[model samples]
Target: MASRARHGGQAIDGRDLKGKAVISGLGLTEMGRIYGHSGGWFAAEAIRLAIDDAGLEKTDIDGLLVNQGMTPLPGMGGVDLQNQLGLTNLRLLSSMNVGGATAGIMVQYAALAVSHGMANHVLCVFADAPLREGRGGGAAYGGGGQQPQPRGMRGLYTAFGMFGVNARYAMAASRHMGMYGTTNDHFGAIAVAQRGWAAMNPLAQQREAMTLEDYHASRWVAEPLHLFDCCLVSNGGVAVIVSSAEGARDRKQPPVYIWGMGQGHPGDLNRAGWDIETQTGAPLSKERAFSMAGIEIDDIDVCQLYDCYTYTVLVTLEDYGFCAKGEGGPFVADGKLGPGGSLPTNTGGGQLSGYYMWGMTPLAEGVIQARGQGGDRQASKHDVVLVSGNGGILDHHCTLVLSPHPA
Candidate 1:
């Protein structure tokens, strides 16, 4: 198997792992508030489900990748999980903390490992117990009540009362509104559309339909962002099984081939002074992934983008070339993201209305859509999907182009 080359017209290194890997199985816990469950417990259960879904036994999992985020349960890292799961043939173990981009990065590593024969089957899992820590369940700011203080320059940001992820996103939204004439109504359209999708999702956290009026009436979390614009912080676990293309051929379910994968970190707002409002690392990552996949943006049939906030989704749509920059507001205004629209985005409702499994939710939903397992919310075209992950305050990004067959 040859390595997939990098995008951006770069020289082929003959070491990039692109289409050689495929996602054979995906599993998730009952999303939303699951009381009295540790992150480790949820992770273990999700791993079991993924393995079974892949038509394999526990022994088949030789690699494990764990993403416990900033506040992991007591014992949920890679080594701890390897011990907890009682796996005897574990050959690869690692942990990731790229914020929401962790899941996509894990898949990149899994593809590399499986393609190189380092591991036959790799399990990527993520879980968090913000509710178990006596924190405000599903709240985004202050680590859901952990109130973790920032370090270094972020400490300066904290002292000036610029704390919390939502605050930063709010600032970005305000800038976009000022620069491009984006309005609260434009942002509201995203909330309404995602909630509409959530209504059809059985495992979504907030399933009640939301209207533009509801979005305007909702309390403001920040100046430009309302309660509906933010994501739901729920307790749950999501896991995916990655294997070599050859290994996936014998799986019980259809394989969603990893056509392309890439990661980019242009800059971090707190430390790098990057422009958060108008720019993101998504374009860089998208270019690389699409280049390796040998497909243009128009080839995408569905998109499962990381929507930690509504603005995030809008900006990403532009950055990924789905629409021109500054046109995202209008592009998503007319129910384009809802069912029977030009583009069906976040079909499982995404983080805004779906369970916020950090980045895992989008990845799982992408696999489900490509496998044609999305029952009610399934898109009309399911051959190709684009799944993206954003981490930190729009600091890091990872993109994956997946398809039912190798492109």
Candidate 2:
């Protein structure tokens, strides 16, 4: 039998680390398509901004964690960032690639480091510049490397023209519709609602007001997935500072306490004997996070769900227990995810309508909401926030619960 903690079972409650660490600072670069900037430049800029925001200097940072999305080029990993920033003293240094789940897992590691006295102040940074005009852009999936295909898998996928991440997610959405009576309009509602939130964020790339009609008229990238349903590819970086709860209390901003965290990885979708349409790793991750936090889903006043696609958000809503299984379509059809809705989600517009920094955008938004800094899109009750990250074709899942007060 599998170990209890392996499947996010009840064995690991995370009580020992609850409220031991907090996010003291959050910083982001101007998010948009930049023609002449490298990923390291953006990462450095974000790190400096975060250190300044935390009211600390580089000398105070003894730990670093870097998440570089889909770019395996040399001198872009954690050690490269340390050298770029010229930090001499370091205790913990690491790099992570969990697809979109990188940022959430970064925080989990940061908390562990601080709680264990392995590091004093940890800087978690993420940067990506995948889209460049004219020249063929770098690969956006699988870290710019080719994966080994099984005997017949390549031929089968090629026959159906099912290449890349979009087609795989499209298949998942199609299966969801067949089983749950979900409609394209249901997915459209998510795009429209997040775009509405994006319209309020000055840093958002797609801030233009989009109506349901506009969403329906948008070009289809794949069956049941429109242009607006997809995430925007832009150049940006984000940095967050994690410190002990006692140290965070003296920082410049209100501390966003780390209450609980959990991670799970369902088998890869590319492999055989995996059902991409009916199953995701989110439920197990959610169970462990909520169990560790000693709170239920209703306690979350705000949510920053990874929005790589509109269907990603809908399936997460169902998997995270915000609504009944297979009832995500009807649950979000009433503008419940928009501003002033009963469940305010993706207040920063998410990757779909906001800038896409992979999972970092959602983590930054969660900290802002917990600190009560979300200007117009702030949730009415910003006490507890639920943040989720999805990697690959729903293969990896990470969940975090943030609160304004310690547990």
Candidate 3:
């Protein structure tokens, strides 16, 4: 298959993009709320488990990547975490504030660190509690956690409303729905397929089987988006270990090679309708990513694109060249993404069912899928998997291509 050209414009100018990194370990907490532990506790637990999975001690991990601003529980910030975890001597530590894309960004950063010899082992962790502690009541929307409501326009209050703004624009942009050959059913199919996969995994929340009828009858969230279309505000932490491919010799689990990774920041704000291909300033993060991986679309055995909303996944499919422009709806509807199909996606149920650890859960899914760690029900003999994340209303895109251990 021909390599998908870079977003068709603007040559990339950055560090060399040819070296390979490897994932040596993976760790994650349960999806639902664990009442006693705080956010920091989740982070610490994830890190500890990830290190143990790698068959290494805490001293083996020198780099730390996490997101802190979420769930204002005690010890949230990166430095606070370092102090809390007693890792004050650590070398590289940074927090990814890109929201949903935090996990993907953390992966990219850790890979870069390993490739450059900045660190021998990088531990990436993601954790948070649901808005309402599974009592079905908390700050389900505005940011996260059980915080008081903001009557007037304020800080996090404004950030909470930002998604509503994105939804409004998405609804307005629906005028092109007919142009794209998309429909509510297309979105429903994506949701149902994910829910099906979630049922197989013991970790997913909404394991119950869903039908098209159930989807259509579901309550509305932002119009065009049913209640099931959006992810739940559940709590959990997920982590992964990264190391140089050459150094994975003694690892307990098979190492999944990091083939290629890239992130994009479209210059447009939430309201703009800029055509990504034609616009000079619109960053083609996905294009650069595919180029770095040196692979074609058909080479990807499975994919996990961020699905904060249906449109997020749709626009990403088009932007990333998964299909021609405006073809995501039909591309996903062809029934090739479910079991025994061309590409089984979200085998872990995704944020929709598995757990809402941002898109971190999807990143873990990609890692496990590439490593052949997925159990019999969702596992297939696939080598390469594409994990993509969307943050802040499609403003930032992160793509990582992973391959099973080399022969």
Candidate 4:
């Protein structure tokens, strides 16, 4: 039970923090390999958009949290960003990264800050532009895939067993397949389904129609992991504004209350009792998040799970109690994650077909779904939304229970 003793930190840590803070605004930019413009530009533009979305001026922002990605924008997390935004005398300022899990963690910390009166409105933003001219995704990430042979220290490290994300996640998919009879078809189903949702999103990078056949036809990124099975390598930014529930209620956009949140860290892959293929931190995180939100699994209307890969989605679904340990393949292959399915997941195409802003991909879509602004990708029931973020080969996890109705 010590693992499940979740607490929202800050000055006021005794009372339940559910419904104490809300995400009042979201800002996004054209993502996925957009040329030019550094991450700082995208971040600044996103913050401005978020401020305007919340009907707040630049000076109204008292706090800022920046989530750094593979390619950190200059002056992103320090006073330089503050100066760029013309925000003076900030009460909160910090830069953080827990790989992809930072988005939900950022919101959780922001909620605590505002709920404890540390800052009235906190801005959380993440942006990355890794692709250089003529280089493919592999070059951006540094691997043998689709790029020239590694050079210098990178080649030495690669020789020393340092691998890219594709290899690591591909190994996870292979392990799951070996243990649970999960197959390429199951992963393909996720890819095709999210692609269907992407067709409806204006900001989605890959909105083309896709079929199961298309998924199978895609080239392999790491066997068992196709190009489609992996998430898109994107260049973009996403920003969210967290405000006190009282302050959010009067904002321009509808408030998506932060009912409950929890985080889990299972430690390094070498750690005992930690298995990347069969287990993750989701078990403990889900217990605390659902308990804090005062809701059961069935109460969830939609899921915005971090989709770093299709396999990641399937494994996470099983860990979050959506299906039994080994049944995620069939659970997702049933066409349930696509639009109009019983369980709509990754409605904005997710990172598979949509732009990848790390955890902000799910967090942004969760906010949109909670606000009923998902357009054709919006689910019918948006009362309760579950958002999940996975970091560092699923070693770190963050779960957030959000809803349109205050708890």
Candidate 5:
């Protein structure tokens, strides 16, 4: 789909950091509904697995970065990870939050650190314990809504903020429909296609094949956003090991090179004419990242765009120039993102069908695909992979261009 306006895969002259670093190891704990542990436990265990996967011991890691997600609890997978893992003398250590974008940003930070001599090996991790034993997935995200009721007419200004993310995304999706004649079917196409991808994934939570009828029959979470529009809640962790390209050579696992990285932060969502419904931070992040990768949109063989909701995939495709604006509805409805499609996107089912680890959901799948380890769902073309993360109410965005070959 992006082949229409494609550029040759040539490195553009700029501050290039292509192939400077690589992800040497990846560790994922059992995901989805396997309760009885804290987020900290998951993070620590993932780090251990990642270190072992890289053929390195705990002492080899000198940097630690954590993404605890938005509104994290008192001990949500960070703050105590280093001490719990018994990792000490860390040259780089920090806890950051860009909402769902944190996982990508953490890798960027780790890559920079390892390349610049701040640290030799860096660990990036994200985890969550949102699923309680007795409660449903909705309970983790406020089944009744996260805000308190308004008492007076003066409280009307807080109307939009009173609900949780379901309402917020519904507004964004509704705006697309009003402006571009988009339909529920367009969003349903995304859900159905990703579910199809999930059916081939062993770690996927919802592997059952779904059809257009099933998507339409699902209950509505908010207006046009259906039950399948939202991501799944999981109790697990994902960790990655970032090392210099030279350091990654001959590692235990195939090295997944970090060819390019970029981050974009929209100043204010309420600004006049802010493109909240029509655009996203992907466009702003794309140029810097692609140039560093020495490639264009056509060179990308696979994509792992964040899919906290079905609308997220549609808008991100439009913003990343994969398809024309307002045509995202039709672009997906044509069945272009599923298996055997022109563009193999979200090959691991994404957050929709994959276990939700915030940005790590897409990032982990990118690593797997780049290493040619996706097994049954692996894309035929594996030269270049595109990964993106969107945070806030589309306020922050980050992109990483990864490849099995060096840049």
Candidate 6:
């Protein structure tokens, strides 16, 4: 087992700090829309519930973190949230912005800070109503309170463009089904499998069961990626509370320890940065993460990879050593990722089925698995799990390895 490296009675080396920080509590508002709640109100509800879950008061929180909301409210920063929540004093704070990777990154940062005694307890919050945003449903302020500048085609695209780039690069390597018998049907299987899980989750946005046929017939958001392959905008908030393992054990729920966590962003836009054809980016983050947990890929029982697009999951599967490069398509075939498969994934329906708080929901799902609250979709309930988050066209990535307490 990987033990925390201690120097003069203090843990060192980011990867080896096992069971130092634990998830003491979890909370979420109903995933879909709230007819009466403003965004701030929704956020407050999540925070209050989390504190209650942790069996602590807002006064216990000495650190604060908030997900970057799409629209900036009158007072929407760390200080603003602190004042609204009545947290007396905050020792550390930030608004970590890595898009979908925010929640996992926040947890990692909190773990390190708490382990080092920089702060006692840290609360991470993610709340959003993307549909209320201008592009999807909210206000479009344009630029300088005026119309957005014309970047021609680039200006028009949103998440669509990100997927476009990932798909284009993925297709370039695979050559759109040459030699191998892979087709979009293989990708649809991923969607179908997730929807099956979502159907059982009352919290999922699109709980209607989908067939491979349904996935194929869906409109094309981007070539090689159908509408179903993409995550939908949702209005909801999720919260997690992290504290020292000793304190977590006294909480209402079983503590899920942060065994390993790693993040990597090798800044490279061109081909030299990564090989889209080979689907290899930097594996250093995962290597560090797995090493931290003192476990290997074979030791993990479930995975909740960031699946903004099917291609991203495929790439991550290979990069993380779940399957050999280019084998992800075949690995997911034949209903392998669903209820009884080897790797029961996205038990909360993920961003695909559950709420989309810029991917915070998926991180919550990972924590859900570690605590064995997977309900009907629970898999092996094994000791170890690996959850990954990808942001900004796979530009930013993080991996978290969680394990249940040992008897």
Q: How well does candidate 5 score on lDDT at residue 334?
A: 83
Clashes of 2: 0
* TM-score: model 4 vs. ground truth: 0.92
Provide the clashing-pair count of each candidate structure.
1, 0, 0, 0, 0, 3
Kindly list the per-residue Cα lDDT of model 4 for residues 1-407, writing each as its tens digit.
34433346442222388899999989998888788978888888889889899998787789999987777666655567778888896899999889889999999999999999999999999988887778887677746332256677657645666467788888888989998999999999899889989999999989989989999999987787889998888888899999999888777898999988988887665667667656888887887777778888899999999999999999989998888999999999989999889999999999999889999999999999999999878898999999999998788899998999887
Candidate 4 residue 137 Cα shift, in angstroms, is 2.3
Clashes of 1: 1
Off by over 4 Å in 5: 1-15, 70-79, 143-162, 269-271
Report the C-alpha lDDT of model 1 over 1-407, residue by residue, as the tens digit. 22445579766633255579999988889877788888888898899889888898898899988999544645534777888789878888888889999999999999989999999999999987666555665343443212266677646765677657778899998988887888988889988888888888999999987889999999988789898889888888999999999988867989999988888788754444556567888877876687778778889999999999999999999988888889889888898888778899999999999998999989999999999989999897988799999998888899988988865
What lDDT score belongs to each candidate, Candidate 1 first?
Answer: 0.85, 0.85, 0.71, 0.87, 0.85, 0.72
Q: What TM-score goes with each of the models?
A: 0.92, 0.92, 0.86, 0.92, 0.93, 0.86
Model 3 alpha-carbon drift over 4 Å, by segment: 1-19, 73-77, 133-138, 142-181, 269-283
Tens digit of lDDT per residue, candidate 3, span 46-107? 88878888888777778888874257534434778777777755668877688777788888
lDDT of 2 by residue, 1-407 (tens): 12346344446567777899999888799886776888888888999999899998889999998898654424644787788779999998888889899999999999889988999899999988776776432244412222345246556665555668888788889989998999989999999889889988989988888889999999887888888888887787899999999877767888899998988787764566766565678878877788778888889899999988999999999888888889999999999999768898999999988898988989999998998888988787988899999998888899999999998
Alpha carbon lDDT at 274, candidate 6? 58
Candidate 5: how large is its RMSD?
Answer: 4.2
lDDT of 6 by residue, 129-214 (tens): 54543344212211222224535565554423433343543454254245345578777878888888888787888888789999
Among these predictions, the greatest lDDT belongs to 4
lDDT of 2 at 138: 22
Model 6 RMSD, rounded to 1 decimal: 4.6
